[model samples]
Target: MKEELSLVIAFDATSDAFAAEDVFRQNGLSGRLIPLPESISAGCGLAWRAESNLEKELTDALKSIDITSAHIYYLIL
Candidate 1:
């Protein structure tokens, strides 16, 4: 799992996740909004998968766009 590092981002709600997806796409962020991974949790039901290294940039971008209710988790896939 150490070889597969990914950043899983969760939103407060489905709409928040979708809004983040739109912002990510508009800003050229490399990631995809997918159903929440079972390994993470069953709650929320949606998440964004991205490279661990891009976390800072993504976080800043999201914040600049006024994106709220996001939680980032670094994990090995």
Candidate 2:
């Protein structure tokens, strides 16, 4: 299988992560909650994974919820 680049959104707090999940789901965005990758040294042990192409949409959705501490990264997963 070919590796693909995905967008990882990490949060400083678990509540923020779950809150973001709700916002994403409500907006009909595509992504899921995942354990924070070992390579990443941030967040509350949970992260959100989504297609890189959804960065803009994700950002907009996040803004609606006042979520501004998310760290975004592009990596093969």
Candidate 3:
């Protein structure tokens, strides 16, 4: 399979993660909520996986929703 570079954003709570998901979807940003990978941890059990290029878009979306403490990780998945 072709390797896709993804930005993994994790939060401290499911609500925060879901909130981010909603904003991104509503704004046409690209990403999806997924189970927290074994590779990273942020106290929350959920995370978001998005294309690398969408990092800024994700950030902006989070800003619109007032979500913070989201750790961003870039990796091939």
Candidate 4:
């Protein structure tokens, strides 16, 4: 079976990650806040997980909140 893939958006700050979650919720994007996965080691302790195909929508939403420096990763989840 193929592994499912998802997008993980990590911020440099925990507050930013939480803020991004709020933005995603406000925009009606389906996602959740989770602990930063160990596979990726370059972000705050928190991350936002969402469908991989929603990159464009996520990017636009993050941009609206002036959060332009998040580390984005595509991972098998």
Candidate 5:
């Protein structure tokens, strides 16, 4: 098996993380909650990981949910 790049969204707070999750769910987006990678920094230790190809969908969902406190990153996992 080999690693692949994924979309990682680090949240500034747990509320924001949950919000993102809800938004993704409501929008039929694909992703899961994961621990924030050590390579990234944020107020919350939780993050949403998704396929890199879903970047646009994820961002749009986040926007609809008014989650502006997330830091988006692309990391190999």
Candidate 6:
């Protein structure tokens, strides 16, 4: 299988991660909650994974949830 460059948003804490999940779910956004990639340990052990192009929208969603601090990374996985 081939991996593609993806957008992975790592939250600073579990609450932020869950909040993001909730916001995304309620808004019918794309992406899923995933274990933080081993290559990334910037924040909590949870991350949001989606197409790279979705970064802006995801960031906005996080903002809607009052998550102003998150680590955004582009990784191939």
Candidate 4 per-residue lDDT, tens place, 1-77, comes to 76789999988888898889999999999999888998998443998989999999999999999999998999998
- RMSD per model, one decimal: 2.3, 1.8, 1.9, 2.2, 1.8, 1.8
Clashes of each: 0, 0, 0, 0, 0, 0
**Candidate 3's residue-wise lDDT over 34-69, tens digit each?**
889887964439889988888878898898888878
- What shift in Å separates residue 59 of candidate 5 from its native position after superposition? 1.0
Top lDDT prediction, candidate number: 2
Candidate 6, residues 13-77: lDDT per residue as tens digits? 88888899999888778888899988897443899998889877888888887899999999998
Winner on TM-score between 2 and 4 is 2
Q: In terms of TM-score, which candidate is stronger, 3 or 6?
A: 6
Per-residue lDDT of 1-77 in model 1, one digit per residue for the tens?
A: 25788899988778878888888888899989878877778754889999889888888878976875688898776
Which candidate should be chosen as best, given TM-score against the real structure?
2
lDDT of 6 at 17: 89
**Candidate rank order under TM-score:** 2, 4, 5, 6, 3, 1
TM-score, cand. 3 vs. native: 0.88
Ranked by lDDT, top first:
2, 4, 5, 6, 3, 1
Q: lDDT, candidate 2, residue 15?
A: 95
Looking at candidate 6, the ten consecutive residues that score lowest on lDDT are 37-46
Candidate 5 lDDT over 1-77, as tens digits, reads 78999999998888899988998999999889999988897343899999999988898888887887778899999
> In model 6, what is the error at residue 51, expressed in angstroms?
0.9
Error of 6 at 32 (Å): 0.9
Q: Look at candidate 1 and tell me the lDDT of residue 6.
A: 88
Query: Which segments of model 1 are wrong by more than 4 Å?
Result: 1-3
Q: Is candidate 3 or candidate 4 better by lDDT?
A: 4
lDDT of 2 by residue, 13-44 (tens): 89999999999999999999999987787443
